[model samples]
Every structure is written in structure tokens, then in C-alpha cells.
Target: MSEDRISRDTEVLVVGLGRFGSALAATLERLGREVLAVETDEYLVQQWSHRLPVIEADATNPEALEQLGAEDFQVAVVGVGTSLEASVLITANLVDLEVPQIWAKAVSAEHGRILRRIGAHHVVYPEYDAGARVAHMVSGRMLDYIEMEDGFTIVKMRPPRETHGFTLGESKIREKYGVAVIGVKPPGEPFEYATDSTHIGADDLLIVSGDTNLLEAFAHRP
Candidate 1:
């Protein structure tokens, strides 16, 4: 979907009150947006009734969705992750309703492709992405990172003991390590961007950007 497809005035419809759906609804409400959430189960509906406009209806049922004014929503998110069949059917119904944008969650790459083919505007593999992130966090000293693209990344890493007490300019990290230090968080002070005079200290968290493998190696450095 385009960045500006949904504006402040646009209403959002979230189907399925699973963890992902409930969290999405809460966040949208927190952002001060009007949200309509639908779930087939009465218990799930009650759980989020106070959070947003909750409707107990089967989203895969086109008639049910229509009764809730689904077509009036600017965007719809299908968060049914357990059943691919249900996800696809709901996606088809949303398309039939002519919702401007529909985002659906899929369990695998194949499911994602199928959802796209069935008219979902965007398909997200949340499980796959979360698994990769968890693996990275458990591997070594790597704290966290954002996958910017295929070959590049931005990561947070704990400073190595070898660089202790060295000022950023004196160490010449960019010249030698081939990774640019974007910012650093000291023991207690707020994070400071990498400047000529910035000094490296123990327990400092460094934010660096560079090649993916190179950044991983830096993260694992002793």
C-alpha cells in the first residue's frame, strides 16, 4: 500500500482478535484512529470490546462483513495466522468489499504468495521474521539489528574490550573496521552520535551500519 493511502480520517478494520489482531487494534486506537475489530468467537470479542468497536462476526462470511460496513474502512488487516484457508477466504471477501488496502499475515512463503494471488495487497511473514531475529539475538554478542536491504544492515553491538578508553577519532573505527559508528549509548547518559570527539567506554552500546556479514563479525568481536 502507498504510504499516504490511509490518512487520519480513514477508518481501519481489523479481522480476527488473535494476539496480532488485538495488538494491532490497540495500537491503532492509541494513535487516535477509528478501528472496527471483528471476531467470530464471543469470548475474543468481549476481551477487546472496551478497546475498540468489536463485532462478533465471521470475517470470511461476506454478508457478515458487509453488515459491519466493511466497505467503509480504508484499510483492513487479516490476522488469522492459524488457518490459511480462513485467511485466504477473508482476504477474498475484503477484496470483494473493495477495501482500498488489505494486509494479511501468512505462516510461510508459499502462504504469502497465495494470499497475494488471492488479492491481498500485502502479505507479511511475521513468524519467519521473528525466528530470524531470535536466532540473531541468541547467536552471540549481537544485541539487535534492522535488515535494511539484501546486503546492508544497521546493528547494535556491545563495544569490545580492546576499544576501551579510546576516543572515536583516535581509534579511527571507520578507517580500519570499514563500519561507520552512527551512535553510542554510554553507561547512563543518553545516546550520542558518533563524532570526532566521542569516546568509547566499557558497557557502551554502539550503533553501526555496514555490510551484513561485516556487521555480524563486529558484533562477535572480543
Candidate 2:
């Protein structure tokens, strides 16, 4: 497959309408991209009617995917993590069909490596990442967050009450906490990213990006 020929605007086919697939389909559709999702179960397909063009078909079948104009889509995601055989088959089909970019979800590191060997452009371990997120949420003071990469994360958190009214510089957050305040969401204004002059307000939600440990420590700060 010639991966370099794939266009950015090409439609995306997501195989599987489970949690990961459903969310990915919705996000791609919202981004103004054409998305075709496939699920083996009729009930699951019905549940995602409002999200995208979902079809009741087994993704492991190359013919089923070809019927949905799979050739027209440059990107595809195989999200059937529950069944290793299904995931592998779907990925192989996508690769054989010459889909330029294939992303497959794997249950483990070994599975992910195997998927990549079969032409998956990227392998995602959703279960492991989701577990980390759940643990972060369960730990009080960590409101919400996203990891931009292995080293950095952007988190939305309520600053400790003691830090209210403190300017970014005054608080010495960057030096003391080892976190960079990327933005602040005040009561009535939009979010403001780090600048020369930004302060922490009582009602503000600090939008920070830095080391994960720093963010976690800030979360537990009293």
C-alpha cells in the first residue's frame, strides 16, 4: 500500500461501534469529515444512528468493507478489541485493500506490536489509558485532563483556595510547582493561555500543561 498517497480530507471508515469506535466516529464527523462505521450487532448500530453512517456488517469481511466504498477512505480504525481474531482480520483486510492509514486497538503491548506488523499505522491500548484516566478522576481534586504526549499533559483543575488572587508570577507556580499555567477560565471571560500577565481567581479553572507528576501533585495540593 502506498501510504503517502492518502489525502487528509479522505473519508474514514471505523470498524466496530463499541465505546472507542463510537467516540472516534462522533469526533471525526464533528470535525466535518465523512465517516462510515461498521458494527456486527444491529442493536449497537441503532444506538449510534445520530453519530454517523453506521452499517451492520462484520468488519473482518473484506467484501463488507468494499461495499461501503472502503477504497475511498484513506484512514480506517479497527476497534474490535474484544476479539483478537476479528481485530487482526479487519486490520489485514484494510491493509490488503490499501487503506493508507490504519489504526487498530489492541488489548496489550504484544497485541499492539503484532497489529503494527500487520500494517496498522498506529496501535492504541485503550484499556490501559482509560484505566489511568479513571484512576486520575477517582483521585479527588483532579477535575479532568488530556495527555498531549508521554511527557506533557493539559489538565483542567480548580486551584486551591489559598492560591486565589495570586498572579501567575507571584504564585511562582512554574518554579515551585513545576507546572506552566497555560490558561485560566475566569467567571465571565473566555480561557486565557499563559502570557506575561495572568492571575489565579477564586472561580478560575487552571488550564495547565507540564509533567504528569507535577499536575498530579498540584491536583492534591491543599
lDDT of 2 by residue, 73-187 (tens): 7788998998889999999999898888898999998889889898899899888988888788689576787887887988888887667888887788888889988888898
Stretches of model 1 off by over 4 angstroms after superposition: none
Give the lDDT of residue 144 in candidate 2: 86
Instruction: Write one digit per residue (lDDT tens) for candidate 1, span 110-131.
Output: 8999999988998887778788
TM-score of every prediction relative to native: 0.91, 0.86
Clashing pairs in 2: none
Best by TM-score: 1
* Count of backbone collisions in candidate 2: 0
